[model samples]
Target: MRISRLYTLLLPAIVACGGEGDSTSTTTSDQTLDVDSIAAAVADQNLPSDSLNEYLRENPFDVDALIERADRFIRSKNIPYAEADVKAALELDSLNPRVLLYWGDVNFYKNQTRQSRDAWMKCIEVDPNNVDCRLKLAELYSIVQNYRESLRLVNKVLEIDPSEPVAYFIKGNNIRDLKGDTAQAVRYVQQAIELDPEYWAALDYAAVMLANMHDPTAEVYYKRMLEIDPNHQPTYYKMGMFYLDQEMWNESIAAFTKATQLRPSDAESFYNLGYINLELGVNDVAIDYFNKSIQARQVNHRAYYGRGFVYERMGDLIRARSDYQQALAYNPQHEPSRIALQRLAEKMAQ
Candidate 1:
């Protein structure tokens, strides 16, 4: 029962092309060109596309070259070109595990989850020990809330490699969401961090689990994460909620302020800041933050309710009533806004 509206970040499953022991290693070009750098250069039109075009023209049937270019297209989020390249590669070698893996990646990015799942399943069928394909399927299952299937797949990966940190992290998330076993979840994620202390995803989840348990030592984990990756804005947001849970208003405010500064467009951070200001009896400041939250995301009913609260506190009943109405308009089922409106109506009748 995490009280924070902030979403947890789940690391993406390792696609086979980028996974350990990827078969694509055999398809490398002698040029030793970095795909990302080449893609950036192409985007800037500084690199002539004719080089790749000429290569493909000369080797029209080169499955390896097609797959290699497809990998670059996938990285650059050019899914259409990725799909075309992978489809061509599959035409030349339909049973190629590496080509199937790229096809899966392409379809996954295209939001064709079923097609992506089937492609990965085919990859597993072709190579029974394809841990990357298994992990991708597990991620899809998790996304659809099929935690049982996800856990089973991850367990199979652990059987193959017990020291897999990402497997432990995935297992921890499945257990926490499916079974509500925070303590057990913490142990699993902690094991991941113990295996690879620099694993940021594991550290993030460890901090979250510790925070849920109200363990003050969660701050230590958060500080360690910041030391590792200072640009991680979600850590600051989570820390603010952690402080808010303990009623540490100033600390919460500072943490939330930092998060807002890092990600100015984050409506949740703005809303949380407003809520904290209201708790601290700073009506005007709370109102301003709530307004900013609404501006960031107009559908944020929580912001509207928070603004209403501040207006009510300041004896501005008219604006408070209007804000309550606006809140209900955004979320018809928001009981707080409904109750507030009801109370306001009664007060007017009196």
Candidate 2:
């Protein structure tokens, strides 16, 4: 089963709810577990650029410093450096529950799912009341399509700390996937938002859920999120999509335009701009946007098809035929391109 893993689409937007827990273990289980060698052994061999020169020099072996640096590395897209720091922290205290949580993340993004799961489970074993670890496990389960287990883990987290808003959020996602119940999902996510009004992920999820039902309140959530962080490009894209679906052309164009401004290389947003302009009969502007979409990503068959349609409408059969052929070359299974090619052939024969 192919899991959507929507949460990973922009991890910086929705981070783990875990705290920096004490490295010391309270449990007697795994009393002789060799913790020092684990982190380095599990450190992923990869490369991205980051530097913690001052921190490494001053607090060479401090777990907190290493974890902080690792965090910086992860944010900078330097997974290898983050892993190295995790390894260093683990070597100092292999059973450091906090470091274990981070190690889970290091492996999770590395696509080492089992390793990530094991690290989180170890964190839970070391700190029985670690709600964050439980939540992480639940999220990982949800990512793998194990919604039942995800729910079970989330329930455990709630039992441990009823005030944990992220637990409710995770539970909401799992329930939505398991039962396809958007209304129920929205209720749980809304509960999370009520508990922690500043929870961005909860706000984003609730808005998306409400939008699924075409609920007008989704607009409120979108506006609130923009108020909180106007530069969040994904939110703008979502707002654009919502507006587009509602046929609010001006609003959609404005939102998508803002999205493109924030993320110039976003092919979909450019393509959407083209689509909207095309629908509005702004032929020249539509062509320009379509061309930009193709520039953003060369393999965009949709952009080719859209441009072909525009060309055909402009009575430029040659350009339309060329674009249709380009679309087919990119995606041989493009039905619209095939039909357009046939239609053009008949027109040319006339």
Candidate 3:
């Protein structure tokens, strides 16, 4: 019995309903039992280079003491202090690139998108060669779904420095969003990998593109990613999907089960497992898994549809109608649910 998991596409436009996708209906039960608080605790100290600390350490006499102060504030998530420090630095040196960059970052964290853009633009104006500023601005644009501008900015960075692996990674993402051209996206990511063999993000993106396309290179890249980072949850989940796609049911189940355990809060994993059960004719078990999937992800239309099908099989028309309607509520374009509802209606009329 080869259980096939759906080829789920990542939709950047869709904001997932936030919560742990657990099998319980209650809020507390829906939360993951395993809380890896250590990760959150060390998140602030993830990398000193990620702070302006390393940059400041190298360029000690870089005009603005306020920039370092702002970095400290930003790293601490002290928005007011960070903003005040940047403003004070700007007062002293209005055109300082470091100050502008920090200010832009603070603005971004604060969700002041327009202000962030303005600050980054100011930084670029002061230091046209500042790759960080350009890259950040490009990323900000991409976040706002302006892929064209993001691509242009990254292309500009590549024009200046052809060996910029980070730029290549961002360019690849933008290419995917704008054109859905997997080949071009893979090429850009491959360029990034060629520039920096240890580029894990590029490898992940490449793996995702290849896997979705059912390319033979997918397994190779996925194995390479695992070699670089064995415990990366996304890679594990993706590997599970790849196995499911390959009709390796036992392998898919193992991978998906591991993925769900690894990322307990991931709704998609539970949903995928449930989908596999549906294909495998484990109706009762499938129903249980689907219930968990819905509990984990309130807006998961697939779970609703699958549950509806199971309810139909059980000769429970009322539950079937409820699940079908719920599915339709989540996704009006869900054709399967619509057809199922129509059939149920016809059955009732008879």
Candidate 4:
């Protein structure tokens, strides 16, 4: 259950957009042109007015042009400008399916779920053949934990693009997370890979699913994902956990140590390292790692539990109880810490 919660916190970091080269020290001329065009489009639209028709009268091929503007504004996190751009595009071409789809995307980013759904509905109305919009709506629902709605949309996308790997990948993700049907999830992911061998997101999702399945084939998947994207943070963390689960202590320690080196303040890596060290009876090292883990995430119950275990082994009953109490304070159902607390209470009575 602790691992499950940890998975929730770590998912975004694993699937975050772009790589290290996403941001640049210098903007190129093309980037500057894109930004300027977008800013001008936003200025022309001037939301709160019905200026889209007038603007399009002057620039008839404006739908694609305005979309570029919206992209720039969205990337820059200029929400107001982005929203205006999307609205302007919609106003110019209300029947333009892609514009409506992007309107939904903008709303989704702004946390306007109902508005997003409305926009997606409009997109489907305009272009009943647009699978991408449906797929995106499904992903948005998944983000909010609306699995049933998500599944419906994804299934619709599959109906349109039968060979779409992403549709199957998302289907597998929802099944793996919500239903815990690992075997079915694994098969879906594998089918996705067979459809699109170079799909990195599908590969990454499959690697995680394989690891969770405790399958020996998980290493093959992880290594393949690493080959495609070496600096992927979640992949490293998952690899570490996989080794740890196998009780391959040295391999586990090395994987976790590398993970920490790559992401210095990651609490899970530190906590795992501390727990493993405590198990191996390296009390001083365990304490040091636990301290680092707590520093990274003060509320981490596993770090406190690992520290308590070390303290109990060292015959420090009072300190052990204190750490156990802290662990239970964070996670009441943490069985090891609860047992440690019970033993400490028995010792006190004796």
Displacement of residue 1 (Cα, Å) in model 1 is 32
Higher TM-score: candidate 1 or 2? 2
Which residue pairs clash in candidate 4? Answer: none
Clashes of 2: 0
Candidate 2 residue lDDT tens string, 1-350: 01112234245322233323222222222333222332332334322212344445655788987787667656656566567778779999999988998888777666656777899899999998887677778887776677898899889888887877888888898888899988998989998888888788889999988887888899999998999998999999999999998999999999999999999998899999999999999999999999999999999999999999999999999999999999999999999999999999999999
lDDT by residue (257-282, candidate 1, tens digit) is 99989999989989998998898898
Error of 3 at 295 (Å): 4.8
> What's the lDDT for all of these models?
0.78, 0.80, 0.72, 0.73
Candidate 2 vs 3: which has more TM-score: 2
Task: Tell how far residue 23 is off in model 2, in angstroms.
Answer: 23
lDDT of 4 by residue, 169-251 (tens): 77887787789898888788888889877666677777776777687788887888778878877778889899888888998
- Residue range 131-171, candidate 3, lDDT tens digits: 77788788777766788988888889998888888788888
**Candidate 4 at residue 172, lDDT?**
84
In candidate 2, which residue ranges exceed 4 Å CA deviation? 1-116
The TM-scores, one per candidate, come to 0.72, 0.73, 0.66, 0.72
Which of candidates 1 and 2 is the stronger one according to lDDT?
A: 2
Instruction: Tell me the lDDT of candidate 4.
Output: 0.73
Error of 3 at 17 (Å): 28
